[model samples]
Target: MPYRHLFKALQWGLILFCLCFAMVGGTMAERLLELLQCQPHANPALRSCAWLPNALGLRLAPFLSAGGISDYPFVLLQNFWALIAVWMVALIATHRAARNAASTAALPDRGKTRYPGITGADAGRWASRAAFWVLLLGLAGFCMAFGTPILGNRVALEVLGALGCSPGTFDPFSSPCMSAPGFWTHRLAVYVIPLAGPLLAPVWLFMAFWDILLAWTLLTAAAYILQDHLSKRARRPAP
Candidate 1:
């Protein structure tokens, strides 16, 4: 394929990312297991598990502190990997489209050529649609993050109530609802306040904008590659 080098690069990048993710996850898991092994009546010094931190490296102390691993780093890493995966898929689709266009161009009668794979126009259109939806979702999240506070806690409480969580018993800092079995409710409880509050709102907004920009960039690149491939194919004489 014309994008063979680019595809290999992406594969190596993904491998590196996975290795890093595994290291982080394994270290965190080991630390958690050590804490769980400590007896309730054990001495404070013995239960402290100082050696675990040392083994994991001093630089990770902040993340390993407070009896748990930080979720932010893991979330960021997962999202980054997801973005890379999407980009790789887009590149593969673009390459396939280019190949199909070339094959189509080889026929003496272009009108009679039956394209067996995705066409350049189709790939570009799908990429554009994906970009639009990503932007729309990002904007919606941005609005929700900023508007939740203005909407007040009543709306939040109502939603929580519908989820079988008691509004009167709900405590944002130490709520069991935050770690509920259901994914949507758990995420709602854990992130709604942080996203709406002054402390993390700016950070969330920045990440949201970053996501939008990445999606747009990916879409633009795919479109450009497809157009270039189609144009080159058009200029080639039929065999």
Candidate 2:
């Protein structure tokens, strides 16, 4: 419990950081999509599209562009969510570990004696199983989120390619293209590419989610260490 206040402050700070980053990334992503679909000369509603891309370009120039310059915000948003998920798992693991340790320590005879019917070992084993399931489910959810966009992108691209439309040359959002075959496929790609492309990029994956996972591991380890120290202290004989 030493530096508990500091730890809490740091946790809140990280949450705030993630929230702000996600918000900014989401906004940028929306704007980037708008810019891509905008035809300012042809559409009166898209006049702001001219300045928005320029502004985003200026802001994002210094940062690493994953997949492409336009895909950076989506990558950032993906990593932000990944970080949040990892934090949730870490918190659950830490809480379960600490609670089990405390329960074991509180049992008679240094957790060796059974109270009534349930023993400390039983409690620890149950906690361990619960933690394992929680971790497994969290990992499954992460993988699903990570892969969904990629799968969608691939299917969309395949559809477009089969219809003889080149994604690079096709303008799916244009009025003329509205009647084109595979229009929906192109539409899907437009949405999926922002998410899928960056995730597929090894450099971006390393730059973003890898760091988040590493931080989660370190924080969880630190929490367990602290919990173990407290449990050991409680187990010592009173002077």
Candidate 3:
């Protein structure tokens, strides 16, 4: 129950942050779109990057679509990715603290000059350091909804169909690419070309949707581990 609450809290916190991010990104895009005479009107609530300030210009969220993040779906993805980052950071910190405590306990404690917190395990520190990349990739996926199709053509198929050609007809093997009038989405089948082996398929999707599904799982696992370690710490009578 405690974990459930933590999970929900993380989810909601990430959602709230993502909404704020979307609003900021959308407002900036609207301003850009308006200046360029692309969309003409501004939709701060939606992603209409037209009259953007001269500074941002076309470089606005090069990875994410213009108005794509303004939508709620991507907001959820962003929040989830943020949660993943939080989880990773927490895990890293806890792991480092544990190692430090262990190493200190093992040391002779001669009061000599040494790093106060000496965690001998380099692996934890390294992985924890990698948390930055997790945040970066997660942020990218968060801003723009990363889609991995388990079934069906793709979520963007209809939008693509609405535009001109059928997205489904596009070669899935070559690239997991599909576009709408002003948007693009990918399916796992298209991403994991050959669509044959289980390992390759999941790995491909993991690479694409890592910020979402993989990140989510990693966060969940990290949270569990952190809670376990914290509980163990709690049970031990402090010195």
Best by lDDT: 1
Model 2 per-residue lDDT tens digits across residues 1-239: 52334445556866775554445644554565556653222221333344434333433332334455465446655435555566666655556656765666677884455434445655565555555555556544544443454553454454343333334434444444323543243233443344545255333333335655576556545555555655566478769
Query: Pick by TM-score: which candidate is best?
Result: 2
1 or 3, which is superior by lDDT? 1
Stretches > 4 Å off in candidate 1: 24-130, 136-239
Best-to-worst TM-score order: 2, 1, 3
TM-score of each: 0.29, 0.30, 0.26
lDDT, residue 155, model 3:
31
Per-residue C-alpha lDDT of model 3 across residues 39-114, encoded as one tens digit per residue: 3222222344422332233233332454455463464354245455766565555556556565666767574245
Off by over 4 Å in 3: 1-19, 22-25, 28-166, 169-239
Off by over 4 Å in 2: 1-10, 19-79, 113-151, 154-239
Residue 111's lDDT within candidate 3 is 43
Shift in Å, residue 67, candidate 1: 12
Residue 121 miss distance in model 1 (angstroms): 9.6
Clashes of 3: 18
